[model samples]
Target: MQHLDDATRTELEAAAFRRLLHHLDEHKEVQNIDLMILADFCRNCLSKWLVAAADERGADLDYDAAREYVYGMPYAEWKAKYQQDATPEQTAAFEARQAEKREQKDA
Candidate 1:
């Protein structure tokens, strides 16, 4: 890996995060379940991470507020607008993936 200065790395990371958020916003058809099934994380996970990081810094950010920051609107509005019910195959795949992760962790 290239040795990046701290400031440069932080700026790049922030830019990448903004790009990811924009990409997700543009691809509203990609449901959260699909993200979870494929990546083992979703927008909600990002929200939680944001809240946790804030808490670590002695900030009092809540999940709902962090989710709004992540989703670019209230999570309920985003969900109602974009989220779809997962198909049986999607759910099964997600479950199998989770089980595999758990087994890997245990091993």
Candidate 2:
């Protein structure tokens, strides 16, 4: 908000992001493919963004650590516990989404 100081705004954003990670943790049934189709981003996307942000701030963070922070556990363990194979319909939707993104980028 324009009215808020920089430190306050950053604090609020960080808190909201933490809540979002918690929310995603609570909804493990929502697969990454569904997220990519609907929202163009997923938990893995968040992990990558975290790494980019850390790099910006000169911090040492790796993809695996960022993923663990987002996932509430190690990536492989989370995959074993909750990740599902994409259904045929989901795969089709994902392909369509990718094509649309490519078209937009080319345009």
Candidate 3:
């Protein structure tokens, strides 16, 4: 395995995070629910993680502000522009996926 210095690793991680945000911004058609169902995380999760990180560093950060940073705009505006209502099939599939995950965890 290639070893990286702490600073180098942190810089690379930040760059990757920026790329991920850019990719998500470009793919607005990818619904949050789909992300939650598939990856068990969504933009909201990223925003929450951001807040948690800031808190760990003793920096004050509001969830709404973090959400805006993650979403590249106010979340409400983004939702109005790109979000679609989930279909019944999507909800059912998401529920089934969650149950499967739960069973796997229990086993």
Candidate 4:
């Protein structure tokens, strides 16, 4: 296996992260609720992670700024453009899955 230098590894990681953001932007039909229920993470999760990463580097990042980085725009603008009101059934299923996850974690 070829060894990557630190700079090369960092560049690759950054590129991969950018690709993920682009993928999420292109697939805006995938709702946060579905992501939470299935993957336990979503765009909001990505935003929070960005904030945490900034904090680790001693940079204070507000939620809106982090969200902009994750969503490729202001969160409200992204919502207005792509977010839909999840159906009641979808909400219920999400809650059920969350509850099940909590129970499993507690066991």
Indicate whether candidate 1 or candidate 3 has the larger TM-score: 3
lDDT of each: 0.91, 0.98, 0.94, 0.90
Prediction 1 global C-alpha lDDT: 0.91
* TM-scores for every predicted model: 0.92, 0.98, 0.93, 0.88
Using lDDT, give the best candidate's number.
2
After superposition, which runs of candidate 1 have C-alpha atoms over 4 Å from their true positions? none
Question: Taking the tens digit of each residue's C-alpha lDDT, what string does model 4 give over 1-107?
Answer: 14998889989988999999999888989999889878889999988998888889999898899899888999999999999998998899899998999999999
Candidate 1 or 2, higher TM-score? 2
Highest-TM-score candidate: 2
Clashing pairs in 2: none
Put down candidate 3 lDDT per residue, 30-79, tens digits, no spaces: 99999988899999999999999999999999999999999999999999
- Candidate ranking under lDDT, highest first, comes to 2, 3, 1, 4
* TM-score, candidate number 4: 0.88
Ranking by TM-score: 2, 3, 1, 4
Model 3 CA RMSD to the hidden true structure, in angstroms: 1.3
Name model 2 segments beyond 4 Å from true.
none
Q: Worst 10-residue stretch by lDDT in candidate 4?
A: 1-10
Name the lDDT value of residue 10 in candidate 3: 88
